[model samples]
Target chain A: MNHQKREDLVKSVLFVFSITASLILLLIIIFLFNEAIRLFQEVSFLDFLFGTKWNPEQGLYGAFPFVFFSIMATLGALIIAIPLGVSCAVFLAEIAPGWARDATRPVIELLAGIPSIIYGLFGLVIIVRFIKVSLELATGETILAGSIILAAMILPIIISISQDSIESVPKSFKLGSLAMGATNWQTLRKIILPTALPGIFAGIILGVGRAMGETMAVVLVLGNSENMPEVVKQLLGKEGSSTVMQLINQVPEILFKPGEALTSAILLEMGPAQVGGLHYSALFALGVILFCITFVLSVASNYILSRSQISVR
Target chain B: MINSKTSDKVMKGVFWFSALLIISILFLILGYVFVEGIRVVNLSFISDMPKNNWREGGIYPAIVGTFYLVAVALLFAVPLGVLTAIYLVEFRKEDNLTSIIRISVDSLNAVPSIVFGLFGLSLFFYYLKDFTGGPTIFSGGLTLGFMILPTVIRTAEVALRTVPLSEKLGSYALGATKLQTISRIVIPSSIPGIITGVILGFGRAAGETAPIIFMVALNPTMPEFPYLFSQCNALTTQIYYLTSEAISIERAFGMAFVLISIILISNYSARLINKYLARNIRR
Candidate 1:
């Protein structure tokens, strides 16, 4: 073929491919909206949002407890991961010598590359066992186990992004602080931290997204219980035999130890669920919520990063 | 002000504590997996079919399936991802349209795999189910191809962007056309970056379980060959299957170790290749 013809053909082909990629995202939104709307027809939108119950078998299907459980696990992970991650980033950027930087940096990068399934395995086998014995609680599985595992999973993203942000801070500021006889800590706190705030925040937000949307690892550990909030409260206070408590008691201890296995419900139960049933719909709704929150977080991160870039320029 | 001695002590404590935590976590996890998995990672473990005995049998089907699916994804993704990146970087003018494309790529990367799972299951499997007869490698591959396209495009674009503007100018100065300059000069200069991006995609495609799990429920035993449209096994699928069997834990760990090894090898190779090409380009 002539060069002109060839070039046109290639360009058109490439355009079609990229369009397919773009179209897939649109399809996801459309499909989710359709399925989620179907769900709304069955359950009130407000009930799905604010209702505490989530027993699909009984036709009580509120999503508040799962939302709370997800938020707590994610927030708890951030609380543990950020301080450690930021501190490590500080060490890498300002304190590590050149040789150490070269060796240590890749190690941190490797952490990011480890698949989520592997993380799930480690949590399931090792972390869960360790926690089960260490806590000595009736239910070895707790939200705390998921938080700790997720914190480790997100640690690298936080550190790597934060290090880049910290390094990008103008050297002049550090030099000026040093000239004024400020200690390294003083320079880091007064000069580096403030300037790098935007990038650091961007990194933390990305880490949050990772934690929030995490599937396999959280699924493996979070004891998958489907308790309404009021039921949990009532169970907590009275020794009386409520129906919810009786049902929960009938379930295996291993299955419900984490008190509520909210995260893994999608991956674990999807395989066996009767198609077009409430369980399946609920999982799809969960997927929809997870997608929206993570998408918003990523967009916000890019915005912050761009703002920081403009500021630097 | 805190005394120098106290400051030094504090810094040392903080650095050591943080460093130790990170190093310990990495080593502990790796060590645990290796110790448990290595016991069952023999040849029999790799070659045997998914028998009732999960502990002694191999993960042959999963390995085959995983590689097949990834190969299919790359077949579709590499050309398309690289080409779109070239168009966006070279041919298209900086306009609102291009900005939309850029934003879309970023958003694409951020979408969760499960959402991609649902979309892939619906659009490719459900809509196109008639063509393939059912969920097969074609559907799974298309889904993963869409999922990994953003990573490939973004990485390739960055690689293309890193090529000096002067090089483009030099090609134009020699009266070369846009296509010639891109293919001859820019691509050669950016080959490392492009390959690195491909490698990155490979790592992702290999490890993905959620998106494909629902779509590709192939037969467990080895299916007949030349069956492009048939269901198949993969490493992640095997891991999932093994997780359920009471004794499959050891084999699952071994399979996981293999998967992790493959990912690390791909990533390390990418970094190495990128560095090599970059060094040559500068010279």
Candidate 2:
């Protein structure tokens, strides 16, 4: 009876400790919302979400620019990363020999472990300079620089997860395709990739979440400008050219212009904003927006990942 | 048939090119930093204090501060994480409460590091200012603790799950209690994995700059011996400051090198531990 009581006590204690993660998460949501809700009282929700300007000093609190930049940078990064990451994943999963896979996996893990700040530094010293000198831009801290850095930062996640998913397509699938006299590439493209699509999609969504939330590297290389990218204005203005030609000329300009992201705005302004003031609340509100976006993405990815795991099992 | 063969050849080339591209990028970053920063990494640079407005001298204080913050973070995280992993692996049933805990862990892991910084500033700096000394190492460390908690829990849980059920059965056959089997048999077998988790968590905490920038790290100062209740510098924040302010490029590279070295070493050692454990388990 005494031993049984002790066992029950230990189990209960462990149970309490296990709930610490839940409790901490609860506190985070409560505190973030509590602080963020105060801003909606001052700024209308629609205005905060859709307003174009973000001057906190004049109390404009327009967050659209940062949101736009976040999306733009994430899209740009995806454009660069998806092909590279997926192809690398395919290579490692389907083509690499045992020793090559073993060697390459650790290198990728090391790349993932490198601090984001170092990536920021590398972007500043190498990428930004290269851009400035080669393109003769006023400043090298363009959305392109940020995207490049982010692409590298997010590559490991995409590659590793996609690789796992691709590899998990049962050997029988490949064998069956081969038995049908399909080419290796055809086997992969038709059988393996389609089966792994959900998992790969989950990885991509997680990568999007990562790109959206990345702060330090973006802060360094994004130039943190509040103005809309010049290309957007040019395209919108439709200045003195055929629409198709104007778009072709202006599309590349988008990558070269300085921009601010939601994460960068928070990191840059949190210091200057007065405590418990509107600016401070607005920053927290930005956090709230970021939190909501990443939370939804993560939950969606998790759901997809779990479903895929179940299907595989 | 010719078309199919050509397409396969082209796709194969593309795949190899992509893989090579990634490997080259990694080498380029590492090699550039190593070459630019190797000159400034002698013993004195590691031991002395900054002399001229952070343009000259060493990064001793920042190094110490990084270790201190990671130590404090691990102090909070390891116990909570290991215990939580223990509960999940050994005691959890397929129930709502367990599901809730699992979801919370995943959600917490998904929360951005910057958001955690904001949350820390609000909770520790504004609300619990008196207790946390309003953005001290204690507050920053705790914030990081929360940020890396999920990582620790997940890795430790993986390790704990790998311990064979037959080992526990044998313990029970000897009339051992569940607690005894856990403490003596399960934990002993999983120590290497648990240590790997702690080391990986340490690497993460040490590398993180966003969560601590506002909460704890301030302008570089000689970190006092017992500076838990005071603001201090960190290697990561130092790199951020150096590059952002254009204070000293060489020093920034040097700090980046040191920081990368620490992170890479921890990561490699964790892999080594995992490999060793796998071998032992197979045996």
| Candidate closest to the true structure, highest DockQ | 2
What residue pairs clash in candidate 2, if any at all?
Answer: none
Per-residue error for A193 in candidate 2, Å, reads 0.2
Each model: TM-score of chain B?
Answer: 0.90, 0.94
lDDT of 1 at A51: 70
A1-313, model 1: which lDDT tens digit per residue? Answer: 8778877877776667657666767778887776667677888778886677777778877776777677767777888899899888998998888887786787777777777778877887877878778867665556777888899989998998899899899888899999999888778888899999999999999898888777767776776665644444445443455677564664333232463434466667677666667767777787788888888998899899989988976
How accurate locally is residue A65 in candidate 1, as Cα lDDT from 0 to 100?
A: 71
Q: Please state the error at residue B242 of candidate 2 in Å.
A: 1.1
Lowest summed-lDDT stretch of 10 residues in model 2 chain A?
A233-242
| Model 2 lDDT tens row, A1-313 | 6888998998999999999999998999899989988899989999998877678878999888899889889999999999999999999999888887887887788788888889989998899999999999999999999999999999999999999999888999899999999999999899999999999999999999999999999999999988975555454453443466766877777788999999999999987989889999999999999999998998999999989988986
Error of 2 at B240 (Å): 0.9
TM-score of each: 0.91, 0.96
